[model samples]
Target chain A: MLYLALGRGAWGELLAKVKVAAIQARPVGGDFRHPGNIRHALELLDECFRMDDEVQVACFPEYFPWSGGDELARKAEDLGMYVIAGLAEEEGGALYNSCVLIGPDGAILGRQRKLNLGLMERKHFGFSPGRELHVFDTDFGRVGIGVCVDFWGPPNVGRELARMGADLIFNPSFFFIFREVWHCLLLARAVELMVPIVAVDVAEFPFRLGDKVFESCGGLSCIIGPPWRDLDDFASWWYEPKFNWILGQLGYEEGILIRELDLDLARELRGAWFSRLLGREAPWP
Target chain B: MLYLALGRGAWGELLAKVKVAAIQARPVGGDFRHPGNIRHALELLDECFRMDDEVQVACFPEYFPWSGGDELARKAEDLGMYVIAGLAEEEGGALYNSCVLIGPDGAILGRQRKLNLGLMERKHFGFSPGRELHVFDTDFGRVGIGVCVDFWGPPNVGRELARMGADLIFNPSFFFIFREVWHCLLLARAVELMVPIVAVDVAEFPFRLGDKVFESCGGLSCIIGPPWRDLDDFASWWYEPKFNWILGQLGYEEGILIRELDLDLARELRGAWFSRLLGREAPWP
Candidate 1:
């Protein structure tokens, strides 16, 4: 792991460069079913690897393959990649909407359950909210997950994760409403936390359920990096490539978005930014 | 008062429409001095009122006329408009950077001191971070102020104010760098809190002190409203007027930006949006 635990408190070390893939695939749960959805996601993952063999992390959208966690873990072990995907887990007579992190060794590393349940998830699906937030350590850096609205809503889980020293945040969302607002939020979260965000959302698709038709307003899966370290690099930070904080993004379509993230820069930025708040000297001049 | 506090927890009522003015003026502290900056600000306020006679609230930038609270309050009483301005406060043998809210009656309503001090503030000036946060009630609505970097920094005071039932927020800034990031943050704060933000920044100007010249990178004062309630109002929310969440804004020049804010719509949106998360029906279908 890039971060090591010292005696009193843990200090972070410079992280390795990470090649990440955010898969914008069709919905895996609800009327779409699971086994087939899981198969499709696996196929997409394989395709992503073929395109970029060095991809270290692969993220799938929320509720994609909402079950069948074992399959994802097995795939992670086979491909020697970190697999992050949303799952619907049943335990203690309660169902949870969760995002699970499967390690390269086929171990279920950990899971961050959705803390803020949405209206549909509460009223109709009877989903219970998660209690604790967790950060998982990886070879590249420490990472945290906030499922869908948990990242967007109040008591933002992303903020908590960033405060816990996560270098990067993964948001597995099955989002549909307010794309513009969501875009602004993603940027805001990246800036506020000083951490890059790997947000993957399910692709748009219409489905039929016993004469009722519903369409998913998913897609806009993106990888947003932290803000610029040197404002002097551009005359106006909002113009041209300077404000291009969205490192890589996919539209409302089914595909994979890949980007090589400099976790070292992100970690350094987060450290420098927070340290200054404590009346410490910033690393930059 | 537009909102009456009921028993148990305070229940909010719809607020009347309010016309607000955000004055973007030159720096008033340090080399610029006190009474001169205060005079300039008052003249700008008069000019704003002349432009929009019904302007009910006037906000000035941080540290501009940083020590003239009495004059601003008296002017507020004279104009019969609520005045919000930044002040360098001396209390308990400690000097603090604070924003004061003065009612139309010339009464000092409340003040929110800077909770997170900047490096220059702590090291160069020996400023102390404030211990308390406050919200002031007026005829239009309850409001909160976050002075400069306090609103932008971690443990954001703006978020706390919004959670404390502030219908609107005022950010008095003397910002110089990373304006693009600041813009995104303002919009994000508005959306996160479900409250509008009236952010007034000092206009850009150069000042000389002991043979050294320092220029202010101020301006970009803006009024950002809450996100649109209806997404279907536009085909693509990111395009044109829909994504133009910054209702009114000024460039890096000394001027006053005034706009009529429908606090009733803001209150309604906030209540409905939060209620939906708690499994209640949204007002809109």
Candidate 2:
């Protein structure tokens, strides 16, 4: 239960099903309006405190703010464990699409906003949306709140946060859009919410994603584990930025895209490879 | 009327409504006693008469007689055009998947037999489904026929050949089942038949679709037109004969991928870049 990730350059630990991290976006926009990206998010949380061991969970990259920084929520309550980010809220005057979460006693455990804005986020930087969705109870069990195109491919808000019983399911995305619509809509909302998706995107977003976009939102910062995970099984992950190609011309993806899901092979590739062949009584409408 | 094609490498060609060609199959072990590849139709009709130009119709890929050539209908009457190839016939004793349609005055302007034969063409040949369909009106117009998973993508026979009018729809494919089915189902059947397709595949057979099973079918040859083309235009023609590689390979791109169909900017990309606002109706259905 200690995975960890934050690609764009380098960062990985993934011992198996949990630890998770990931923060590669470098767009410098999204509300707080980049202050050199909060000094690169405090130099990326001082390198996620020398790469955690037991409990971790860094995550970021949906709004990437700092314009006001209430001491950046007291630096994730002094970086204890779960930080989870994505910002750009504005309350009354409008402009939402937030995320928040912070724990390990850093406070805040619930925020969620972002009800499918996308498509140039209401004509670039206007945000709005987030109507209902709160979920979190965490320790490790019932945590919820899907942001970023509200858990895409319409997995009805993570199947209504797994019918309001959520086991995990954070989301964080800034998916600049298009890449086979993020793997056929976020890997079919982590294989139709059986649960266990950590997701986080934005590995170097300053621009450019046109050559038939296969980037702008993928390195599959996935942590998802539940039915089907073996993109040719190589232990998982590829959205590298910060490192790989020597800072891939400054875009990002340092490192991190690991996997070890044995949550019963995600319930046997989603109940025997897609519930006896594309479940819900298959045969697409 | 210089719409020539007859390729086997990059992506084949054929337009009007849409036409792709190739049946270059090889695993005779799939039985039907292997026959029609006529030495890959005289080495892909001598590379389409060294880069075809005035054909108006040309295709071939399925089992071009399992590469056992000598007479590709006298090289389609010495390349006068109108070929539409694919073969593996063997009548009476059963074993169709054919194509024919010679013309350039060579005659036989029709023959189609391949109404879907997947799963190793229903276990080692002995096919049997294409009970009828010739549609060759000529002078470059009503062309029709289907084979190799008849334009698969949820049982679609090009809207029953544009509701039986078909201005052009030939498709002699081998779409290389492997090669990452190139982004799910041949670019969604060339953006759902906006017409003018020509998809051959089998640039280099002779075994090694990794020795078959689990996936083989090579080549990628494609050419989808109409919406003024851009499913990422291509042109290589042929390859897959030699080499090892950690990263070491080059040399192979037969020719002919031409597009120039300003046919009035494909009718001004039919109102809003085509997806159904189909201005002049992509050609029926």
Best by lDDT: 1
Q: Over the stretch A73-157, how does candidate 2's per-residue lDDT look in tens digits?
A: 6776676666667777788999886777777556766678776664356654677777788776544445676775556523346
Candidate 1 lDDT by residue in tens digits, A41-82: 678878988989888889998777777788888888888888
Name the runs in model 2 displaced over 4 angstroms. Answer: A1-18, A21-55, A58-75, A82-84, A88-119, A122-181, A185-285, B1-36, B39-58, B62-70, B73-185, B188-285
TM values, all candidates: 0.81, 0.33
What lDDT would candidate 2 get against the real structure?
Answer: 0.49
**Decoy 1 TM-score against native:** 0.81
Instruction: Give the DockQ of candidate 2.
Output: 0.02
| Clash pairs for candidate 1 | none
Q: Worst lDDT window (10 residues) for model 2 chain B?
A: B237-246
Using alpha carbons, what is the TM-score of model 2? 0.33
lDDT of 1 at A160: 72
True-contact fraction for model 1?
A: 0.33
